[model samples]
Target: MNITVHRPGELSAVDRAAWTALQSRAHLHGSPGLANPFLSPEFTLAIGHERRGVRIAVAREDGEPAGFLPFQRSATGVGRAIGLGISDCQGLVHRPGFDWNARELLRACGLSLWEFDHLVSGQAPFEAHASATFASPVIDLDQGYDTYLRHLRERSPKFIKGTLAKERRLSRDHGAVRYVHDERDPAVLTTLMGWKSAQYRRTGRSDRFAHPWIVRLLRRLFHTRADSFAGVLSVLYAADVPIAAHFGLRSERIHTCWFPAYDPAFAKYSPGLIMHLGMAEGAAADGIAHIDLGRGQKVYKDSLKTRELMVSEGWVALRHPVAFGHRARRAPVRALRNTVQTRPELFEPADKLLKRMGRIRSRGGE
Candidate 1:
């Protein structure tokens, strides 16, 4: 029942093999939050040249590699689950019957507060006392693309009908629609990142694409391949022109949707929505069961999701010297983040203003 935390890069060959095996046994894995190879020691070391402090947590059931957790602990003793905004899955990966105390793990990592946004569906520990959770919608395109469309019609008749009609309009006017899966084109991925960054600013959110390491990690994923952590880049083209693109990770049977971007010129076509539809069909064709769209309450996710799962997120305060000061200062910020969620409209004006200003600065045009 003893669990130990290790740096992700410190894992040996044997440890890596065991970790991957344990991951395979999970019912529905692949959040692309912290489980991807890009977050692994090999991948991280390859991409994270300057930032090498990310740690890997491994829980051993009597001296065997039972679980592994990947996270980055900051200077303030606060450990943030890696891929915070972008990753959907969070928390440690362990086999059944392995018990862990969240507090201990935080202590082992020399942290007071362990934070995660999409902390997986059933793995988080400290959330029982104070936490919030939500489901990410996913479309089931098992029987076939046509069958999925039928189910979508039955479940969300209006939404399915509208998107389909829009698809038709886009085809009739724009030209024939074409889908590319596992597209080897890095240019498509580059395009997606640009659009995603723009979308982030337009929606008044932090632009993750601005970070060099993160951007490098994604480009690496686009090139690397593994049965468990292969990149599945999807793109949609109209009249031979790229309109929408998404770069996600595929672990054999799970296609965890990640970065997505589309040309704003085709906003009426809703290429992003079309990209998801095409994604489901393509993923199902490749035998991928779950398209882990990650956690969020986006309208398009609701429109395409045929099922949902709830995941929780929160923080744990460490009992140390800096811990007290950290909590005292962070407490108000936590309250603010929670408040921002509850009273989104209150913050929307300010956020929008900031984003508008950024756009204005970038464009330098009226």
Candidate 2:
């Protein structure tokens, strides 16, 4: 096997074709949700245009492309999975039965350590380095939306009924509620970013939208359309006024739920949940087979999920001084977060504290 690295934009047409073919084959023979759009070259290329650090590692065997790993490298010889925080799935796009080594792969890329928080399952090479694994919930909709709704009804009958009732009440009180599965209006997207930023602040989380690069990335993706990948912005309106919205990426069969937010004034109506239902119904019609809700745990995820996908959080590193220093710097915070997420007793207090801090910050800004 031979390995070579290139900037995302430097990939040749033949390289692009090979990557797409391998991705399609993976979808055909692998698990149902393996056709993640985030893993596509289209995605990495878009990100590379926005982020200069992005690079791709192309591996060849017998003179044919065997695998691809897209990542971001820092000057300090540290690396990360491309779009680590925002990407729902992370793994090398490789042919099945291929043998690879994680550490060696990093060495080839000139990195002492490669960190990832959302490593997709079935990545045997990275499994040994994973400090902890978490359940990433998903809604399988291959049988269509009705089938998915039925599953929800079985799991939480009252929740479904209550949500529908709230939807009806929301419509009557505001205006006739309508849903746009692929809204083209840029203004609505702006509104979504505003709401999302507020949501992050209210939850005591860093507002990703505050970063200009992230905002630009979303805009670029929103206009991108292709068979293997497209950016979808779904919105719900009441009396022609947008109340809730979601912006996610989709391939032919997989819809990855990314940024979702709703007008806080409509919180009583549970607009966020309403927006998801609309997205699911519309996505199924568009040939989407599954919706990846990402790696975090939440009540809504438990109520809506048909299955769970496992993802890992950790770093793969060589025994080098830089790698050791990086680990030492991050270990305390990483350990604390993992402990809280894994323990209900500790998690609740940490969550409350975050909310308290969020409130304080929001009030100060106001």
Best by lDDT: 2
lDDT of 1 by residue, 19-54 (tens): 777666664443333343334444434433435557
Per-residue lDDT of model 2, residues 1-366, tens digit only: 999999977899999988887777676767444468888898899889888789999999999998899999999989989998888888788887887999899999999999988887888898789988899998888999999999889889999999999999998899899999999998889999999999999999999999999999999999999888899999999999999999999987889999999999999999989889998899899988889999888988887789998988899999999999999998899999888888999999999999999999999994
**Global lDDT of each candidate:** 0.72, 0.90
TM-score of 2: 0.97
| Index of the highest-TM-score prediction | 2
> TM-scores of all models?
0.86, 0.97
lDDT of 2 at 230: 91
| Consecutive 10-residue window with the lowest summed lDDT within model 2 | 26-35
Q: How much is the lDDT of residue 82 in candidate 1?
A: 69
